[model samples]
Target: MIEVTEKAATELKTLLEQEGKPELALRIFVAGVACSGVQYGLALDDEVKEDDVTMESNGIKLVMAKDIERSFSEGSIDYIEDENGKGFLIRNPSAGGGCGTCGGCH
Candidate 1:
């Protein structure tokens, strides 16, 4: 299952509050696959499709597409801060290099 860190959860809550969409769930999915690895996208969505997988973490609801669920199954989303800046990072141990069509990923 996907996990959300406390900091990430807090940030998500603040963003949702600012957007005035408290009912919206955080949607995460694989937007594309590249040579570096799979790219992830996130958004606040109020709609939940029939095939979507829903889970709650730190009191926040997360929705993901069923077809890409395995790509994020054991990953954790975290909010981090450093000298450079701050942003959300998805740490997925299963991710690997190369796009699926490149025949370079094994």
Candidate 2:
């Protein structure tokens, strides 16, 4: 199970509103190809895949694909905004023994 903080939930809500996609939900995705062993990806998806595990927390819907769900059983995603603007930052505990930002060939 994944957890979303109050700050993160608010950030997501803002994005959804801006995109004018009320049907969209936050999808927590992971891939094994970065310079590191695993990399995380997050996006607002309108459709839930068949192999996805869905959960709703803190008034936000979370979807994790089957392959990613195995490696990313838990993690935290936050919305960060600074001099560079706004973006989603994923803190994945499963990212172990990885290389650079690519998360590949670890």
Candidate 3:
């Protein structure tokens, strides 16, 4: 299972309120791409696929695709708002070296 930081929870709550999507659980998946070889994707989903691992924490439900669960075993989901702006930030331990914005990640 993956852990979600308090900040991330709060951010998600705010997003849900703003988007009018409270019924949706936050879905996290690792797609095959990014400068680090894999990248994270987040979305509000209402249905859990057959290959998903579902967990609930801090009043929020989270679902991670089975294929990405292993890669997400040791990561933290964080929400940060700084000079650059605010959004979800994934601190994955299994990613390779890079800023995840390098060329050829696509």
Candidate 4:
């Protein structure tokens, strides 16, 4: 199962409202592999194929490819804000990385 923080849910809702696509669900998937570990990508999608696993958290719908769901089975998506900027972050212990961060891994 996946989880979404309140902040992320609010931000996503705001984004959908601004984009005029509130019906779209958030989709997450394996974007690529980096030096640190597996990378993930997020987008507003309207399609949920048969190979996708869907879940709801914080009143927001989320979908991910079934084949890669194990990679984030118990992960949590949270919003982060600091001097460096702000964005959504996915944290999964099974992801196997130095910091579990998606920033530059150099």
The TM-score leader among the candidates is 4
- Evaluate residue 73 in candidate 1 and report its C-alpha lDDT on the 0 to 100 scale: 82
TM-scores, all models, native as reference: 0.85, 0.79, 0.80, 0.87
Give the whole-model CA lDDT for all candidates, comma-separated: 0.87, 0.78, 0.80, 0.87
Best by lDDT: 4
Q: Looking at model 1, which ten-residue stretch has the lowest summed lDDT? A: 97-106
Question: Which residue pairs collide, candidate 4?
Answer: none
| CA RMSD, predictions in order | 3.4, 3.4, 3.6, 3.7
Candidate 2: regions farther than 4 A off:
83-85, 99-106
User: Relative to the unseen true structure, what is the C-alpha lDDT of residue 71 in candidate 4, on a scale of 0 to 100?
Assistant: 74
Instruction: Tell me which of candidates 1 and 3 scores higher on TM-score.
Output: 1
Q: What is the per-residue lDDT of model 2 for residues 1-106, given as tens digits with 9 covering 90 to 100?
A: 7778778998888878898886788887654465555777788898898888898778899987887878887878777889999777887787777555664554
Which regions of candidate 4 fall more than 4 Å away from where they truly are? Answer: 98-106
| C-alpha lDDT (0 to 100) for residue 50 of candidate 2 | 88
In angstroms, the error of model 3 at 104 is: 12
